[model samples]
Every structure is written in C-alpha cells, then in structure tokens.
Target: MKKISIILSAFVLLSSFTVLNTVWTNDDPHSQLGFTVTHLGVADVPGTFNDFDAKVTSSKPDFSDGVFELTAKVGSIDTRVEARDNHLKSADFFDAAKYPELNFKSTSLKKAGKNKYKLTGNLSLHGVTRPVTLNLEYRGSVENPMSKKQTAGFKVTGTIKRSDFNLGSGFPEPMISDEVRIEADGEFVK
Candidate 1:
C-alpha cells in the first residue's frame, strides 16, 4: 500500500509541472513597449520600439512561468528631430551601425497576486545585458472582435540602470537619471 501511495504522489507532482508549462504565443501587432530617456539634462525625451512574442502558461488561471522575446529595430530611433535622431543612432549611444537590436528573455517568473506576476529577465541593449524584474498585470482574455480567436494581454513595467548598458554616455547624473523606466503592453493568444 505504501509503495502504491508513493507512486501516485510522484505522478501527481510530475503532472502538475507539465500542466503548468503549457502555453500559447502571439506575435507583433498584438504587443509593444515604449521607452523614454532624458537628453542633455534638459528634456524628457521619448521613443517607441515594437515586435512582441510572448508565451503564457499557467496552473491556477494566472501565469505561472512564461517567456517573452521582443526585438527593437535600433535604426527606428525617432525623437522628432532628424539630425539628433541620426546622431543617437550613431556609435556613442545605441551604435545602430553595429548592433541593431535590443532583446529581453525571461529566466524566472513568480506569481504576486491574483492577476499579477513578478518576472525576472535579461534585457540586452547595445551589447550589454542586465537582469530586470517587471511587475505584470493581466488584462484578461477576450474574444477578438474580428478574428474569433481568444486573445489575452498583460501590462508590465520595470526600470534599469542606463550606465550598466553604456547608454548614459555624455550625460552627468544631475542632468540625466541613470535609471530608465520601461513600460510594455503585450497581448498573446492561447
């Protein structure tokens, strides 16, 4: 009897893990993140980057563990100024001439509340990679107005040190804060 009980326990544990990892993913036109970094200690500048692919898997109607991949085209650095935007794409900051994409990949994810999760991931920018934790909120699943497939979305926010990524070049701390806040709203399908 004890042997049978042990075997049943092991099977249940394995099944739990397996079910928790099942997921669905949706690509771009469904999610995006917009960013803003200060410039010359004078203005709160803004820019946007998009291209989203995220997977959602859960056990209790909430996300358990998932992965996300977003790639921002470096040359699309728009700040409303042609010359300044071009300069930003040059070697000093983004170095768009060389490395042309910023990526984020998840390493761990933990549930915080009923519809919130704390996600730990590595953000790669301009060749520098750093860990960032994003606080995410589930926007709930919905029936697509046109497509008939189920769509779910989440909002996530996090901050990172710019100096760690060689992004704060030519600016003093008093002028531009080293911390950059990233906000993203991403939707996925299951």
Candidate 2:
C-alpha cells in the first residue's frame, strides 16, 4: 500500500510539471509592440509601447493550439515626439488617465501559409472591445545559452481603424487617418 501511494504521488508531481511547461511569459525587454499611422497624408509616423506583457500557452511546441493574452499600458506610448505623445495620452486620444491599459486575447489561430498564421482575437482599447485579426509569422525558436531555456519569437501585424474603437473620433482622414497599423515583435520564454 505504501509503495502504491508513493507511485501515485510521483505521478501527480510529473503531471503538474507537464502542465507548467505549457505556459510561457514575455521577455518584455526584448519584446516590442508598436503601431504606425499616416501623418498628414504623406509619411507614416511610428510609435511603440514601452511597457507591456503577455502570456502564451501551448500544448505543442509548434503552437498550433496556442492561446495568448496581452496587456499594454497606454501611457507608455512613444513616438519620439514628446508633445505629440502627450496629446495622444490625453482625452482626445487614448485617455490614458481613464483607460490605462489595452488588452488582447486570442480566440483562434489558423494556418495562412508556411510559417504564417491568421490570428483572430478580441482587442479592447479605450473601454471598447472588438474583434481583430493579425497576420502572425513564426520566427522560430532558440535556446538561450545563459538561461538554458527555450525562447520563441513571433512577428504580428494587423490594421485597425481608430474610429472602430471610438478613439480619436471625428478626426478627418487627411488630418489623422482612421487606420492604424499594428506590429509586434514578441519573445516568449518557457
């Protein structure tokens, strides 16, 4: 009976470890989430969020059944222009004071082509949530020499209309285009 009990305990411990292996966290410093918008009908202005985090869970190494959840601080937006950045954080734009974070959670992922996938998810920004689809390209994985852990990289790109989220509403397209291009270079560690 004691031997049987020990075997059961070992099985439980192994099961827990297997479950833990499925979850991965963002290596925030090495990861980036950014966006671009047409400025004055000519050049595109790019910006990045300085603070963000994400968690990914997958039962397979290929991430065919992966789930992702991400949150980014609205106040961390940077476009290399302080005045414009400040304005973006104001009531006219993201309203960082009221809505502090932007969030996304994956609903589905389907193969689009080799090493590419169509990821559909719910994106919440400025108190509004909507479905968004991103083209995700798996950048492959590597073993970190220092940490001796596996790290995976992905590039995600998508376009969303600011008007869809009730953000920066009523702004003429030529002044501030309705479309925003989203890009993320995400690194996840297991």
Candidate that would win on lDDT: 2
Best by TM-score: 2
- Give me candidate 1's TM-score against the actual structure: 0.77
| Candidate-wise lDDT, in order | 0.75, 0.91
Write down the lDDT that model 1 would get: 0.75
Give Cα distance to truth, residue 116, candidate 2, Å.
Answer: 1.2
The positional error of residue 158 in candidate 2, measured at the CA in angstroms, is 1.0
Model 2 collision count: 0
lDDT of 1 by residue, 1-190 (tens): 9999999999998987785454767646867677676656677876665443456665545555566555678887676788977877888778987888887778888888988888898888999888988898887888888888778888888778888999747865756778777788877776
Error of 2 at 67 (Å): 0.5
lDDT of 1 at 106: 82
User: Which residue pairs clash within candidate 2?
Assistant: none
